[model samples]
Target: MTAADAASLVPAAAAGRPGTEFRHGLVVGKFYPPHAGHHALIAAAAARCAVVTVVVAPARRESIPLELRLDWLREAHGVTPWVRFVGVYDDHPVDYDDPAVWDLHCAVFRAALGGARVDAVFSSEAYGDELARRFDAVAVCVDPERRTVPVSGTAVRADPAGHWTHLHAAVRAWFVRRVVVVGAESTGTTTMAAALAARLGTVWVPEYGRELTARKLARLRLDRPDATVFDVTWDRDDFVEVVREQQAAEDRAARSSGPLLVCDTDARATAVWEERYLGSASAEVRAAARRPALYLLTDHVGVPFDDDGLRDGRHLRAWMTVRFRAELAGSGVPVVELTGPHERRLAEAVAACEDLLAVGWGLADPLLPVEG
Candidate 1:
């Protein structure tokens, strides 16, 4: 790896010309959960080469899916058109000194590239020289000392909360702790969700079912001119739409939330609402339900039901609370029932969220070299 072989860093906007030193560049990594450091290396490669090919090779035993890693890399580098990303499963044991192990790993990389010529190999590892020699290419090492980004896959896997700022929005969504507040109508669900989000300095997802109910009532009044909330009718399709929109909103919010995300309601709660109006929960609604990290069920025991105009379940609040408790119990997810004044309920909700965060993301260790 001579000085001439190492390409100087350049801006991403000024890269991707055919007359550069290398025509084709290659980068390979596990990218278990791509952090800022990984992005910087890929950007550096894209800066000097006309076309860069990134190979994401993770072991089959790894926790994160190969397709998801590819998706994250592609999305992060979508601005650079010259960069291409591919993925392949590599379960070979890690051994830098053995030639047979090298051959096994390079074979997987070549298969992913489909015989494309690699004139330059960009990496931050000590094995860059050997990898470049195998491909008969120059080694362009960037940030070999981890001084720029100051983060690694191992550090992130062990403690995501400590390195939260180094992770991309998409990757953060994978580790975000979701706490959903669910209960009967007007049972302080919205208020508690907003309060929790504010307390944690994060974002909260509003219930889509409430929005849809208001929309339905407004549409009915346009025809009858005096229609009330009771005039609004709900069908199987309405509940399905509610579940779809609710999950979409939750996913969008998760990307921008802090380590913890607060939700007014979730798809599982939509199933309960479906049963309330439609006589039974549909298979579509049930199938769309996903388990969150924790559920804070606001009991209707002490909370007063406030109907602003879109709610018609004042008398059914007690029944809805019972149904919600039963549903959450059957799902096998952790749930905490909140029963008391607003202050007490919020305190209990916060404590439950803290406990959920304490239990870190239990990601399995990646394949590594053994000490002699």
Candidate 2:
């Protein structure tokens, strides 16, 4: 079945009639990286209970943050007045047969619930009955065999790309590999970013700085009709604004991107532009720089400078390229310099991205129950 079909089966809280079978239902899980199956389980609980409290209890060592998991759940489910999400650190070891360990975990859950009474314990695990017994609640197991939505936190952690369809937009944003193309003027940064995105079947974020520059020059020419690109002025605030808008654009695109996201430039590259114009980079702009998965630097060696009405950096291209290399050296992110022609550059970029994807996301495993 299609993803939409699967989503349609998971009843929204508004569509569910107020069930008299339970008052306050409790759904607990590590939710290390919540997937479609987890949402299905929660929807089942929300449909039957007057109020459902989802306790996001993940161990400390898990790669995905507890708070981020809670945010994704809340975002995915939308405004459900009766459904509440809470998170707590459950660092206790997992042992189903050990009463002491169960008690420790229960104490953590109880603290998160604020001592609220649970009428039903909703889960998809074998220990649901025991968890309900401890809470003096009824055990409501949903899709214990994984027939409804075949996914798990462990499976998602192991291979996010394999189960991309099972993830929500917010969760996908967190896992999306950001590949930024940054370079000197007339070096085909925009061309490479767009071409790579098209080749990979993903979205590309245009350079916000270029748009802002055009706007600045347009506004400048209102009084001086003969004004040129050199007439445009630069300030510390302009670079910061570029960083803000660029980062925001990247974020919006990432939510809907495929496994890979291509960007013409990022905040870090904005810092370089700031230094080029202002002679120094400000702390505000520098602090906003984020590390992406990979960087594709377009070399200006053979590429002829095209004086696009917005560009005045023909002489500074070599200097800017050297500076970008210097800044990215300490970033620790993998950088691939593209030269030769458009086809060769694209081929090199595609190979670099493939290698990065092959590395995979090495998320640490969450604590699992010991089998008898």
Best of the candidates, lDDT: 2
Predictions: Cα RMSD each: 4.8, 5.8
What lDDT score belongs to each candidate, Candidate 1 first?
Answer: 0.87, 0.88
Q: What clash count goes with each model? A: 0, 0
For residue 292, what is the lDDT in candidate 1? 88
lDDT score for residue 303 of model 2? 98
- For model 1, residues 1-372, the per-residue Cα lDDT tens digits are 111122221224125375666777889999988999999999998888887888888998889999898888888999987777777789999999899999999998877777767889999999988999999999999998999999999999998988989999999898899899999988999999999999878999998988998898889988888999998999999988888888888899888898899998887898898889888899988998888889999999877778798889999999999999999999878999998899999899988988887888899889997555
Distance from true location, Cα of 40 in model 1, Å: 0.7
- How close to the true structure is residue 41 of candidate 1, measured as C-alpha lDDT? 97
- Clashes (candidate 1): 0
TM-score of each: 0.92, 0.91
Clashing pairs in 1: none
Clash pairs (backbone) in predicted model 2: none
